[model samples]
Target: MNVGFRVHQDVLRPDRALLEGFAGAAVGNLSDAMHGLYTMDSGIRPVVTPAARVTGPAVTVAVSPGDGLMLREAIGLARPGDVLVVNAFGATDRAVLGGTVLLAARDRGVAGLVVDGAVRDLDEIASLSLPVAARAVTPRSGTSTAGWGEVNVPVACGGVVVQPGDVVAADGDGIVVVPADQAAAVLAAHREVEAAKGRPSDLASGGEARRSRADVVFHRTRAAMAERGATVVPAAYHRWPVPPGPTAASRPDRA
Candidate 1:
């Protein structure tokens, strides 16, 4: 079986602080923070949120269907600020993204997309305002019916593995799969990343280091607990979203 698609290797990655700075930590917290986030799951039904573009906490899709036509139907359902995530159900060599589909995604206000397999329309997908990231490009296209499949269901994709509604972040550095269970923590992590990194940046800007020994202890404790697979440490001290620079992130009050 063939799957996946083509995309720009020069894609851009959003700031990890930007991804983790959201104060809203629930399902509806980043309701409007819809700009980025993508999954590499195959047969995903990516629906674009009709709301304004959000910069953080973008819930991605993972579909494990065998049908390629329904996949296109899912793309039709997307609104705006959405990055369509598709998994070709173990088909990485087939072309799922082509000129026509890329145009449709763009016309529907979709912002971007990611696939773990291959794509056919290279020049056109690149030209659209919608950003696409994938593994390879091919001269092939998806079969109207590759047999059977489902939409909106959880499916494993890419190297990290993913499920529907899991938050995804993609950029030039590649894509990060944020589990739905970890969304709040991941979203919360960005703040610390920004703050931790910001401490250095502030000093670089001739500002003082506001962090204290207590803060160091806090991170150390969290890191220790996390290393043991405990929930005591948040993503801030664990991994990703790393520590931010002194500048930190610019976020509006979510409350």
Candidate 2:
């Protein structure tokens, strides 16, 4: 067995309609539906504002630090609306993809690219308008001859274990991964959340309902804290155990 250098040609992707259900869904909502899990770290951000939220099955790629040989291969294998999620060992000093390569992925109908390492060619990338996200940007390029990586395999990108065919969604806010098997349930939960919030048009007139929901959560949290023996006594800062510093009025003016 080649171990780290092998590729698995087949990935179990979610149904097309299931993937389409995630289109235009907010990453925040998806994260919330997952109970605040499956969100990529904040450091991974879109290199450019994507034309829309990129949502599709993940084509996972694992690469040796500072190399992109497998990334290119993944691009070639990707079908339309497949997101290439690259795990580059979080290397930031060398970019694995640049403008030219990103253009190639765009031309190949790749839905988007997310790298845990670095990428360059910001200007050209923006011009191409493909949805690309990475942890950093650098001009230094990596050598492709290292040739140690895998494709269509599970990888850790942005502190999350991304399996091939897991649904990946990214927008300006950030990226979130939905386990392939849980897509339908998460979508149902997301719909429930939206329903509870009422329609976007009703939000302006629903301030009271929003406040009521917040109060319920706040009081529940306070009750839990009380059961945990936590207590708070409101007091002015100057009245605390430590002696208060001189007040502004008591300090001598420089003038």
Candidate 3:
């Protein structure tokens, strides 16, 4: 299938400035930002470097049985800076991406793809050096390639709202959604986090305790536990360790 498109970098205007770069700030950490990050259930490991930048707004597709074929047309509709995001409705084992569809995106220079389902053609897609994010990898191909989709629609990739023109950033850590309004703010927050992180990791680990403050909470906790026949100890007093065994109340014969 032949696809055609070109994007002027000036028109897209992706932020390429060098900032207080943190190692993993560009993409939101899943642990802290679970609502925004979509986890791919992939075993084939689509590891991409940060240099794989995104430029366009998102072109969201909610895929059904015959929707896989719309990818070719999606690429045709997408300009250089667009990301093709697919909602597969949890059909992760069957491949939603293939060699043919990938060629269409690569040829048109679409930035990348994010799918909430499975994708195949690993070796071939990798050879083309396409940036793709998906749930898993499988040998299974979509049953049909017929067009069944809506253009410029909103789709959910694990609760993250992907709309047309939203910036989708993803790397090994995970994918993060930045609504057009917050894209610049997220970037600013990223720079601040990186700046703070520059302080030695050891410094954060060092002197993390106030012996007096901990003693109060520990003693209070221990006293409460002891009332219920349980033993507790604070790390500050290593010698007074809590005993590990069934207490008198735990043994019926003793009662």
Candidate with maximal lDDT = 2
Model 3, span 1-255: residue lDDT tens: 122121212223234342112223545332233444433333323434433544345777776632576566567777765678777765776887788898888888787888777888888877878888776777888888764554456677755667666666656655666665555665566556444333234334535444444565678788988889985445555466678999898898998
**Clash totals in order:** 37, 0, 5
Worst 10 residues of 3 by lDDT: 1-10
Better of 2 and 3 by lDDT: 2
Q: Give the TM-score of candidate 3.
A: 0.62
Which RMSD does model 3 reach against the true structure? 9.1
Given candidate 1, what's the lDDT at residue 228?
94
**Which number leads on TM-score?**
2
TM-score of each: 0.54, 0.80, 0.62
Backbone clashes counted, model 1: 37
Clash tally for model 3: 5
Global lDDT of each model?
Answer: 0.51, 0.88, 0.61
Backbone clashes, candidate 2? 0
Of 1 and 3, the candidate ranking higher by TM-score: 3
On the 0 to 100 scale, the lDDT of residue 118 in model 2 is 97
Deviation (Å) of 67 in candidate 1: 5.5
